[model samples]
Target: STGGGLADYIPFIIFGAVALIMTAVIIEVQQAVRKIPIQSAQRTVGLRQVQSRASFLPLRVNHAGVIPIIFAISVMFLPTIVANYFNAAPVDTWYYKAAHWIQGNFAPDTTNLPMAITYNVLYFVFTFAFTYFYTAITFEVHDVADNLKRYSSFIPGIRPGRPTEDYLAAVMNRVTFAGACFLGFITVILPIATAKISGIPHNQMYLGGTAILIVVGVALDTMKQLQTQLVMRQYRGFIT
Candidate 1:
């Protein structure tokens, strides 16, 4: 019985290991940021003059983070959920047949190749779409450009104001695309790979890629906040 129990738990152990690896990879990817060099206008301190100070604006690849995953999952499940309500209809009826079809195809079961393909395709599309959508809403290029202009800071070689905004927008779109692709791959492909490799039932694989992504993304954001707070405290200590 002990040996049998261990064999039964093998799939779960594999799933957990995969989850840990996925989380680590996601966190590492999330930590990667593109730093744009900026220079502040020259200033004077007391009787002496100071040269322009250099700094950088850090832009994260996964700015939208888990929000996109949450949004996509909520949207993706609506069809299956709505179809389930018509389960009581006669099998010969259109609604019953439609509901069954949705349950078989759109539902979150990776065992069926055709259903898995359909579901993953839609999942990828929705996740990618929401990543771009959420990023667009949260990361405002014009605001960043305006703030930089107000602070008398400029990206090296780029003109301030409209040109700067355009440049930032272009860079952000490129980064967002990379992030979205990663999210989609994680959300859809990872679970399928786990099931195929581990010989685990798709329905029983609860530690899916989407869940891992959300967990890791939230952890990374929380760590970033704590680090920022620590930096602020250190700076305050220096000032006092």
Candidate 2:
């Protein structure tokens, strides 16, 4: 009995270790930003000619963060939720069969390999799709272009109007794709890998990849916000 009890906790221990590693990785990725060099047009200040101001536009790779994961999970569970209403139907009826099928295939089950595979596949698809969708909605190329133009700032080689918008959009697309792929991989691979390695049932492994991702993403974001606030307070003190 003691051996069996010890064996049961192995999956949890492995999960905790993986979660810590992933949290560190996510924090590192969140802190990384790509800086785009920009130069402001020269202006005359009274008698002296003021040199152009140099600055940079910082873009985060995972701008959407945990939002995509939340959206994806909500959408992915809809079918299963709808199927629940048909559970009371007669066993011989089509509704009953459909409900059973949905439960058996769409839901996550460690003992059922096919169900697990299908669940992971859908999870990956939803995660990847939502990552791009959320990124597009939140990060508008036109707005960024307009702001840059308004401030008389321009990228090193890029023009100030539509070309700049196009360039920004192109870069965002590439970055978003990379982030989406990483999210999908984590969502699908972690649970299966842990289950296989520890010989634990999927149902028993509660700390899946998606959960770890959301937790880490939220923690990192919170830390960033706190840091920003601290910097603002320091600036305020300096001003006074």
List the pairs of residues colliding in candidate 1.
Answer: none
The root-mean-square deviation over C-alpha atoms between each candidate and the true structure, in angstroms, is 2.8, 2.7
**lDDT tens readout by residue for model 2, 64-167:** 78777788779878988999999999999988898888876786663577877777788889989998999899899999999989877899899999999999
Model 2 — which ten-residue stretch has the worst lDDT? 103-112
lDDT of 2: 0.81
Q: For residues 99-196, write the lDDT of model 1, one tens digit per residue.
A: 98888777667458887677779889999999999999999999999999987899999999999999999999999999999888888788778987
lDDT to native, each model? 0.87, 0.81
Distance from true position, residue 128, model 2, in Å? Answer: 0.4
How many clashes does each candidate structure show, in the order listed? 0, 0
On lDDT, the candidate that comes out on top is 1
Predicted candidate 1, C-alpha RMSD: 2.8
